[model samples]
Target: MTLPDTPEQTPLTADTVLRYHLCWKHRDLDGVMALYHPDIQYHDFFQNRVLGFDELRDYVRASLPHAAGEDIVHSDRIRVDGCTAFIQYQVTVQGGDGLVAFQSSEAITVKDGLIWRINEYATLVRRNAKGSDRSSPRPATSRLGLSPRQLSTMAQDLEHYFQRQRPYLDPELDLQQVAEASGYSRNQISYLLNQVLGQSFYRYVNQARLQHLLASLDDSCTRMPVDDLAFAAGFNSLSAFYKCFREHTGLSPKAYVKQISLRART
Candidate 1:
């Protein structure tokens, strides 16, 4: 089906962008896909995925379901330049007494009045009603009788296990194994990581893996290829490793290595 281009051939505006955003929030797959050009290129840099129209459609369909009952909080600022637009928003999902917000920004390119290309990045945040201060001490989970000190100790022990044992380097390492080894229930571990440490299990693990990778980089004698280094650091996918590395260090691996080399010379 062919969508009509704007009569005046005007670039996409905030209104046009909102139509697409609203369609996504409402989980209207057809409406979402209708705004895309037939030859669309969708780039999810975090996933290291570049998808065409068919893959884009499948991804949108699969992802929208997760937003079915969630609230979409859109930033008021939508910046448009020529045929491109930038938008930011957060998808808030219920998490026990609080909410877990996945915030994302998209750079969209429009052609012939349809979305021709898109690049998106996302991060997470946690929020609660009454706007409680996140830095304040958290109350113990009702399910676990452990005091704050006990939870803190468990978090530290878990960190030590992950760092010294390098279980994160195992692509198959999972919460169950960690729990079994540490004598903590999976729920308790998850609660400690999420509620106390303010991160998900995978997020904490990946951060550890990224740190491990950096330590390897620090060893000038290390001769492993960057990809091998990433794998050895326990990242299952190269894309995921790159994403995590960039998120943690604010630079890609190659750039980071170059910076380190220059610093050593200086």
Candidate 2:
């Protein structure tokens, strides 16, 4: 797995790579996306270039259905340069007629400490392996028996939902609503957010709302009142808003707003 020749750089360790792989296997999109640079440019194997955060978000969302719950496996690092690295892997997805479709020789490019692009040059290694059945029963309870691939798909879907719908604005939003929006059930959503991601539903929603409020404060043209902004960000009460704001940003809403205003002035 020789990386392209580039300037000398520190390569990410195997442990780091394994950790990232587990995060992906866990279908933690937010966890995965946090690794990439904000201004990433993704080049697909089909020569499609996805530019910017929003574009990457959409591209990933659209690709999820095809890749979810597949037998994806990654191999050792090929090479690394400053802020860039590469890895090789193979993936097997269930195909029509109960066949196992294998894709080999996949390559991934990580830039600025995140996966910037993936170029898969693959062929079907084998087909029709035993026990390659695709059909499975959906979980009866809230917990979806989602493989890593399915969770990855759900995570991507949730990311798009967050960007487009801005569900964080409803402080009362719960696992059921989020599950409905993300096409999972209440139990599955609860398990993903609570067990997998290690965060409660309310905490996750509050964090998202706080982040939304922070972004709103960054807007130059909008001068929103604190109380209105709090409600708009989906905080049920002023006190809760204040408490969450302070906890998340380590500053009161007023102070955070003032800081943003000051930063904007500079």
lDDT of 2: 0.57
Query: Between which residue pairs do clashes occur in model 1?
Result: 169-234
Q: Write the per-residue lDDT of candidate 2 for residues 1-266, one digit (tens) a residue.
A: 45333554345433334455665666666665676566555443322333567765544443344434545666554554543445665544321123333233434455545555554343333333375433232222222444333444555566568778999887778777887777777776665455434457777677778778888788887787988988898899888778878876788877877888788789
Clashes of each: 1, 5
Report how far residue 8 has shifted in candidate 1, in Å.
89
Which clashing pairs does model 2 show?
1-78, 69-149, 69-150, 142-187, 142-188
**Relative to the unseen true structure, what is the C-alpha lDDT of residue 93 in candidate 1, on a scale of 0 to 100?**
39
